[model samples]
Target: MLNKTASRSFYLNLWLGLVGLVVGIFAGFAVGISPALLLVAIVAVAGLIWFFASFEQAVIGLLILRSSLDLFSAQQLPAAFAIALNALTILYVLVALLTGKAVKIDKFWWFFALWIIFQSLWVILLPLGGLGMDASFLMSGVRVWLRYFSWLMVYLLVMQLKDNVPPEKIVSMLLLSLVAPISIALLQIFLPSSMLPSLLTSQGKAGSNVSGTLGFPNGLGIFLTMFIALVWWKLSISSKRLPWLLLLGLVSFVFVRTGYFTGLVAVLLLILFINSTKITPVRAIGVVLFCCAFLWMFASTEFGQQRLTEIYDTPLLNPNIDVSRSIILSYGDSNSFNWRIAHWTYLINAWSQFPILGYGLDTSPLLGIRDFNTGSGYAPHNDYIRFLVEQGVVGLTGFLCFLVGQGWYLVHLLRNSQSVNSRRNLCLILIALFVANIVSMLTSNIMDATTFFFYWWTLVAIAGWGNEYWRPNLATKSA
Candidate 1:
C-alpha cells in the first residue's frame, strides 16, 4: 500500500529526527546549549512521529470494523464502537448457518429483545411518530447512539475475555483506573480552577468539587464506590501485602467529601457487610472508629464544616427561595434537589400516560419540559424512572431481569461456589460492586450509556464468564 516516495519520506524523516536529537544532545556540551531545549525538541519530534504511528494503528482498528468507523476523518470515534455489534451479529449468524445451531434464547435475551421490540412498536404507533424524538437528531439521537455504541464495544471486549482472563487481572485493571478519576477529583477539590487550563477548557466549568473528567460529582462518587469494592474484594482473601485498608480509609474520606449521599451509604454498607461476614466485634469497632475519623476529617475542612452545619440546620434553616428547581436560587446557596423532585414527579406522570411502552426509547421522563436556558429536557436524576419513561413497561421489565437475575445469580454463586478463599473473596467483591452500582443509580441515571454503563456491563460480563471458575466443564456441557 505504501508508495516508494512516501516510504522514502517516512524513513528520511525518522533518520533526520534521530540524527537531530543526537546533534542537539552533543552540541549542548560545546555550544552551551540547554539540555532542556534539546530534550523538548526531541520530545516534540517524537510526539509527531507517534501521532503518525497512531494514525496507522487507528486505521487498522477501523478496517476491522468493515467501514463502520470513519478513520480518515479528524472528528472520528473509536473503532471499538463499530466492531462490537458487528462481532455479536457475526457470532449469531455463524452459529446459525454453518452449524445449523439456533442461538438458544435465554430469559435475559428475551427481556432485552422484548424491550427493543416495544421501543420500535411505540415509535411506529405514536401519533407524531419517531419524528417527534428526532427533533434534535444531531445532538440527542447521535449522542445516545454513540454512547450505546461505546457500550456495545465494552460488552464485546469483556465477554470475549471472560473465559481466559483471571479475576485478579480484572481487579487490577479496575484498581488502576481508580487512580485517574481520583487524581482528577483531588485536583478539582484542592487546586484552583485557573491552575489546570487544559482540564478546565475540556470540562467547561472549574472550581467545583464535582467537576472532573466524568463531568459530574455523582458520577465520580459512583466510580469511587466501584473502585473501593474492587480493592475490598482483593484484600479479603489475598495473603499478599495489599494496602487495601489504607485505600478503604482514603476513598471513604473522598466519598464523604463528595457530598454524594448514595455513595456514602454504599461504602458504609460494603464495609459493614464484608466485616460482618466473619462477625468480629473488634473489626466492627474499628469500622465505627474509621467512620468517625472520616466524618471528623470532613468536619475539619471549611467546606466540610459548612456542609455539615447546613445538614444539621436543614429543618430550621429556611431556604427562602424556590426549592423545586434544579438550580436553587436561594441567597448564598445553590441546590438542585427540589428540581429533581419536580422532575421525578413529572416523570411519574409521563409513565402513567404510556404505561405499557412508555414514551419510546431514549425519551427522558422530562422529555417534553424544555430547560429555559438550553432547552435540553434530557436525563432525569433517576435511572429506574428514566428506564420506565423511555422503554416503558417493557424496558423496565427487561432491566428488572438484569437487576433481579444478577441478584439471584450472585446469591447462587456465593452459596454454591467452591469454598476456596480466593473464589469466595471474588464473589463478595462482585456482590459489593453490584450493590454499589445499584445504589449509585438510585440518585443518578447513568445505566443507559456512559462510563457508568460500560463499567456495569463489564462487571456483568465478568460475573457470567467468571462463574465458570466455580462450575468447571459447565460451558462445554451447555455448548
Candidate 2:
C-alpha cells in the first residue's frame, strides 16, 4: 500500500534515473551541456531522488554514475552526489518520526539520529547559510549534507533490508563501486602522462592529474585498501576463486601507482586482521602468496618503480640522505607530511579567534588562512582541524562526543557478538578503516570531502549495523 506521492516518486525516479544514465553513460558531456553544468544537473537529479525516494534513490544515483559514466566525468558528481544523498536521507529519517516509525530505532539508529539533529542545529545557529542568500553557499550545504544523508540511508537500508538483500547483491554493489575506481587508477598507472591531462581536465586544477577514481593518489590507495580488506572478508565467507583473483589484480595495480606508502600499511594491517578472523590457514596462505605476486608486479612496473622511488626520495620517513630532500623542502617541508602538523598548528593558533562558536559553521575557507598549502581554497586536510575551523570548538566538541559515544557502543557490541567468527571479521574491517583514517588524518587530512567522507560514514554505519544485528546472538552464545 504505497501512497500516490511515493508511487509517483518511484516512477519518476526510474525514468529520470534512466535519462541520467543514458546521458552520463557515454561521451560528449551529455549532448552539449558544459561539463560544469552537467555536473550540476547530476547533483540536481541526485537531490530530487534523495528528497522523494528516501535514501534508496540516492544509492541508485551513486550506482548510475559510478557504473556507467566515464571516470573523468564521474569524479565530479560523486562528491556532490554523496552530500545530496546524505542530506535527503537525514531529512527523511527525521520526518519518519511523525509516522510512529520512531519506535523502530534501535540504539545505533538513535546515535545517527542525534548526529543529524546536531548538524541541523549547527546549521541553524551558525552562519552556515552564509552572510546572505548566496545560492552557491546554499548549494554547498546541500552537497555536504547529501553525503551524510547517503551514509545514514545506506545504514538504515542495510539494517532494515538485511533480510531482503541477498549476500550476492550486497557483494555486487560494493564490488562494482570499487571496480570503477580501480579501473581508472589502473589507467592512470599504465596510460601515458601526455594522455592523463585530458582525462584529468575535469578537476580543472592546474598541474598534475589528481588521481582519478578516488580523486587523489592517497584516496585511490584508501579505496584499494578497503577493497582488499573486503575481498579478504569475502574469501573467508565463501571460496570464490574469481573474485579473489580479480581483487588481487586490482589491489596490486592500485599500490603500484599510488606512490603513497599508506596502501602498503593498509594491506599489511588487513592481512594481519584477516589472519585474526576465522579464515582458514590454507586460504590465508594462498592470499599471502597472491599478494606477494602482486607486490612483485608492483615492483616491476615502470609506474611502480617511480612510486617506489618517491617512497625513499623523502627524508621525512627516512632520515638517511635522500636526494629528494631539497625538492620536498622546496615544496614546504614542515607541511609535506600531509601538512597535518603545519595545518594543525595554524588551526590551533587560529582557534582562539573564534574558540567557542568557531568561525561559524563551514567558514574555514572563508577565513583564508587554512588554504595555505595548495592555495586552492580547501578545508584543512584533517577533519579535526576542518571541524574546528568550520564549526568552531563547540560544534567540533559535539561531533567528537558523538563519535566517542559510538565507539563505546561498539565495545558493548563486540563483547556481545553472537558469532565469534563474524564478529572477529567485522572487528578486523573496522580496525583497518580506523587505522587508515588515522594515517590519512595524521599525514594528509583529506577525509571531510567527497567520496572519502562517504566511505567514512558508510564504514561507521556498517559497524553499527554489525553491532546491532550480531550482538544479542553473540552474547547468548558466550553465556
Candidate 3:
C-alpha cells in the first residue's frame, strides 16, 4: 500500500515539474530573449554567489575578474560585467551593515566619503544647472560617481574583513590577480599582432606600442609599477625569495617596455629606497641578473630601442633649447615630456574660469576630448590637474586631504609596527605603491577604470584593515 502511494506521488510531482519547465520556456520565448534579460540572469547569479560566498572569496573573485577585464577592450565585454561588479559590491556592503559587522571608519574614510558625495552632488546639479542636461553628459557624470562609489564600497568591505581574514591570504590574492595580465602582456610582446586580438593592439596601430591587456600602455605601466614594488618588497623580507625575485624581473621587463617615464622614475626611486636596506648575496645576484636581462632585451627589441631613443632624445633636456620653445614644440608633437607641461598649462588656464568649483565631475575628459586629433586630448594627463579643472579648488582640497591622510597614517604605521611583523612589510609596500601612483599620476591619469582603481583602493583597503586590527600590537612594539 505504501509503495503504490509513493509511486502515485512521484508521478504527480514529475508531471508538475514538466509543466513548470514548459511554462518557463514559453515565458522566456514570449520575452523575446533580449540582452536585458541576459543581463538580469547574470546579475541574479552573481548576486546569489555573493550572498552565499564568504566575504574574502567574493572580493578575491571580483579582483580576479577585474584583472581579466583589463585584457579585453571595453567594447568587447558586455555591460553586464561592470553592472554585476557594482551590484555585488553594494550587496557586500549591505550584508555587512545588516550583519552588524564592526566596520572601521577612520578620518580618511570620512574625508573620502565627503569627497565622493560632493562630487556626486555636482554631477547631478551640474546637468540640471545649465550644463544642458544632455544624456551623454549626464551619463558620463553618472559613470564617474559609480566608479567613486564602487571604490568606497571595496574599501569598506575590506575593512570589515580585517579581523576575520588573514593578511597572507589577502596578499596571495593580490599577487594571483596580476598573473593573467602579466602573462598576456608577455605573450603580446612575442606574438605577432595579427595573431592576437586586434583590440589588444595599441589603438589598433600595428607594432606601435604594446599596451599589454590593459589596452593602454600607461595604464599597464601604472599597474606594473605597483606590483613591481610589492614583489620587490616581498623579496626583501622573505626567506624563500627566489620566486619573488623572478617575478620581479618579469614585471620589471614589462614595465620598461611600457616606456612610461613617470613609472620608470617611480621604479628607480623604489630601487633606491630598497637598496638602502642591507641586501643578501643572493638578492644582489638576482638584481644583477635582472639588470643584465633587462639590458639585453632593451637592446634587442625594436620597441625598446625606440623608447630608449625617445627618452634620450627629448629636447627638454638640452641646455641649448629654450624652455618655452621646447614646450611649444613638444605639445605640437604629442606624447612628450614638454607636451605634458604644456597640457598642464592649458588645463590650469581653463580652470581659472571656474577655479572655485570648476566645471563638474567627468567634464575634464569631455572638454579635453576635442584635442584628440593632436594625439592627446583634454585628459589633462595629470590627475591632479584633471581634478582641479573638473572639481576646482574645493574638490581638489578634499582629494588632497584624503591623500594626505592616507600618507600620514601609513607613515605612522611604518614607524610603530614591529620590524618582524608581516604587517610592517605590507605597510612599506603600500607606502611605496602610493608614492609610485602619485608619481605616475603626474604624467598619466592613473585613477581611471583601468588597473589603477583596483590597485589603489586595494592599498587603501589593506591600510584600513591594518589600522583597525593591527594597531594595538604595533603600538605596543613602538612603546
Which candidate number maximizes TM-score?
3
Worst 10 residues of 1 by lDDT: 470-479
For model 3, how does the per-residue alpha-carbon lDDT over 1-479 read when each residue is reduced to its tens digit? 78766765666566556756865675576468675775665566566656556666776676766766755556645244556666665655554444443456656667668777877766776756633234456777777787778777666656656667765557666877777677777777788787877666644223544566676777777777778767765664566767976788788777777665567667666665555455767656755665566566555667666655655435556666555665667756553666666666667777887887777777775554355456545577888888888878877887787788778877877776544455666677677777766777777787774566666677666654543454333222200
Q: Quote each prediction's TM-score.
A: 0.66, 0.66, 0.80
lDDT of each prediction vs. the true structure? 0.55, 0.55, 0.65
Candidate 2's error at 33, in angstroms? 17
Quote model 1's TM-score: 0.66
Superposed on all Cα atoms, model 3 deviates from the true structure by an RMSD in Å of 7.8
Model 3 alpha-carbon drift over 4 Å, by segment: 1-43, 76-82, 99-107, 128-136, 202-208, 277-315, 331-335, 366-378, 466-479
Error of 1 at 374 (Å): 2.9
Candidate 2 segments whose C-alpha is farther than 4 A from its true place: 1-76, 79-104, 128-143, 193-210, 277-335, 338-340, 365-375, 418-424, 453-479
Worst 10 residues of 2 by lDDT: 470-479
Error of 3 at 181 (Å): 0.9
- lDDT per residue, candidate 1, 1-479, as tens digits? 45755765665566566767876666576346676776766665574455335633332232223211222123334334444444544543443333333333224334434444444444454444433243433344344544554444444444444344564466456565555556566766676667866644355232234534455556666667666776666665445524777887767666665665556667777766656667567667877886678667656766555555554323225455333422332222433344455566678777787676666556683463457798768577788887777767776887777678778767666675544455555566678767766776776765642455556656555554434444332212100
